[model samples]
Target: MTDVRVVNEQAEQLVGAAETLFAAGVMARSGHANLSARLDGERFLLTPGFVRGLRPGQLATVSLDGRVLEGELSSVSAEIISMHSAIYRARPQVGAVIHTHSPAATAFALAHRPLPCRTEPMLRFGQAEDVPVVPWGPRGSDVSVRGISDVLERRPTTAAVLLANHGLLVFGPDSAATAHLVVAIEESAEAEIAAAAIGGAVDFPEGAVEAVRASIARVSA
Candidate 1:
């Protein structure tokens, strides 16, 4: 049996994190995103659908097989759960996953373009010059899950991936790390857009990029 207490705590934390993101303007007015974390050995705690703005006690627990645990909320996000399940199955090191439709990040995704790395912050997260886009599949379909899995399998060091015409998904060693990644990606996206407006060559200096990567490694270590 899953550990009920741990699941409940994770649920509460997930909701709280969602609310914090909403307050920070990272989430849309209707709560279009989902956040999740692993619970015990075999299950995950996820935000329920249409919960609107999240609150401390308003999350749900779900089994790996996608069954909703009783007594919490119902109505989970099918696509979100599918993506998270595939990620967890493929990457055992990831303890938390965050999906958000923050305007800047979603804008790049909708355009089917990668955000160019033009600053040190972008290099700090995996030294990725461009955040790759996973091709779209029918929402709530296993195809979406498999597509994302394939990307991660190829780029295991990637901290985030953009879903084509959808939004962004970030995974980390824990919820806090995942949250940090979301903020980093949003900032990088904003920087890339702003730099393009100037219409000149713009890139982080190599020495600075290496320094930022070293700092990130220290923190991650």
Candidate 2:
């Protein structure tokens, strides 16, 4: 069993991230979102209800096998158990997963279109290929889980994907990166849409992604 204090700490992180996303205008019109972080290889802590105004006690501890190990999961949250679990199983290195309906990104999702990797933020975050769109499926169904897992498997470098006619799904090595990726993707999507009014957004020159990667390596060094 994971320590209660540790579980609460993860919950607190979700709460803080929720606040940040809300302030950044990423939450859906209904203020609904879900976030989770791995507690261990065996289980994770998930947001149990609406993201806005979330509290730590309102979290659910779920086993990777899909069991509710602790706390109560709201009905809506219950449905997404498989959706998030699939990501953990497919990408063992991922420490966090977030789902949101940020408007601009959802517009791309709604249109079943991928968000092009034309913006610097997208390249900086390693999104060289356009953010792929997962085919629509019934929420939490095997089909939905399969769609998400398959896309992640095919695009190993992508940190985010648009859920067809639904919203956005993002995962990363940690909560902060996952949150930041969602924001960057949404901003990029908004820019892409607005840029359509002029001449449409343009892709970066060849090797732009590699250039960004080199810059990151230099900064780290």
Candidate 3:
């Protein structure tokens, strides 16, 4: 069993990240999503089903295999538990995961459209030029898990994806990075949508994608 105080701190951290999302306009209902961070090799801390007004003591500690190692009777969101578990299992390097329902981004997802990578923000911060929309699947089902898993596997460089008619999913090396990516995605989607209202979003100059990718590689190296 996880220590009470230790888990409490983790819960606070999750809430802090949620606050960031809330500020960025990614989420408001709180019931719309969840966040988690790896606790150890075998487990992670997940927010209770919804956290709009949840205290720090309300989070859950879940094992890698999907067991609720620690939490109350109504802790985990049954609809999204598998989605979170699959991501953690598939991406060992990811220390944090954020599920969001940012309106601009979710609008694209709802329309089954992809997020354009034309914006400088996306080119500089994201690995993929376009954020793929996952194939539609019933929420919380194995099909949903597989749809997300497959896209992440195929586009290992991208940190975020739109869940068809669902919302957005983003993971990163830590909470800060994940949160930044979440905000970036929201902004990018907003930009794309706004530009569409006038004419259409213009693509980057030829070879821009390669140049950005090269710069990122050099910086990381």
Candidate 4:
């Protein structure tokens, strides 16, 4: 497809995902989380800083290096430019990235706890073990980028991460799927809290994990 067509499609999808997330109450009224889609090998589309009431045309078009190729500079998530760029650079296969400060998951991050991958939704669409929690970093800093980059580099299959005292970041092959993952991570965190309130949740056995992974691989393939 033409560049214009691709960007428009990406813009539409990103807008839809953002609105869905906001409506689900995962995204805040504040400009906390943002979504991005790979427009090409060298460029991508990022959500506007304020997404709750945004239009598709308002999203920013940026290079893989975080250069604003199009859109108002004010619309970009300048703070997370490095975070998004680093993910694309580290994982060429990743087509979209999402950052959210969903309460449940962020609660886990605040406590420096790994989100257990016990629930079916998390096991199937999220990670196999506990989701890693990266060290804390001030907003829009190199430290934040590095914290996230380390996990993406070490665990290439990682679908989500809990940024210490920050929030959650998730990516996938498409904007819609990645957005779904953001929600799934929050759900897993909520489940963990509920389970802990009782006694503790049982983790999947090593063999059970392998079976589920194998099943997911076949279905995805």
Specify the highest-TM-score model's number.
2
What TM-score does candidate 3 get on C-alpha atoms?
Answer: 0.85
lDDT-based ranking, best first? 2, 4, 3, 1
TM-scores vs. true structure, each candidate: 0.84, 0.95, 0.85, 0.90
- lDDT-superior candidate, 1 or 2: 2
Q: Rate the local accuracy (lDDT) of all candidates.
A: 0.73, 0.87, 0.78, 0.81
Candidate 1 per-residue lDDT, tens place, 38-112, comes to: 875567777756545576465666676767774364434654667888778887888888888878888888998
lDDT head-to-head 1 vs 3, winner: 3
CA deviation > 4 Å runs, candidate 2: none
lDDT of 2 by residue, 1-221 (tens): 78888887788888887887887887778987889999888899898658778888888889988889888987778999898999999989998999999999999999999999898887776567899999999988999999998998899888889999999998887777788888888899999999999999887898988889999999999
Our tally of clashes for model 1 stands at 0
Clashing pairs in model 3, backbone N/Cα/C closer than 3 A:
none
lDDT (tens digit, per residue) of candidate 3 on 1-221: 55767666666777787777777776645457778888767788877656566566667777877788777535237567778777888888888888888888899999999887877666665535688899989877889889988988898777788999889888887777687788888898888889989998888889987888788799999
Tens digit of per-residue lDDT, candidate 4, span 1-221: 23788888988989888877877677754757778998878888887656777688777778867688778656236767778888888888888999988888999999998888888777776566678888998866888888788887788788888889988888888888888887778888888898988998887766887788788889889
List candidate 3 stretches off by more than 4 Å. 1-9, 28-31, 73-76, 207-221
Please name the candidate that would achieve the greatest lDDT relative to the true structure. Answer: 2
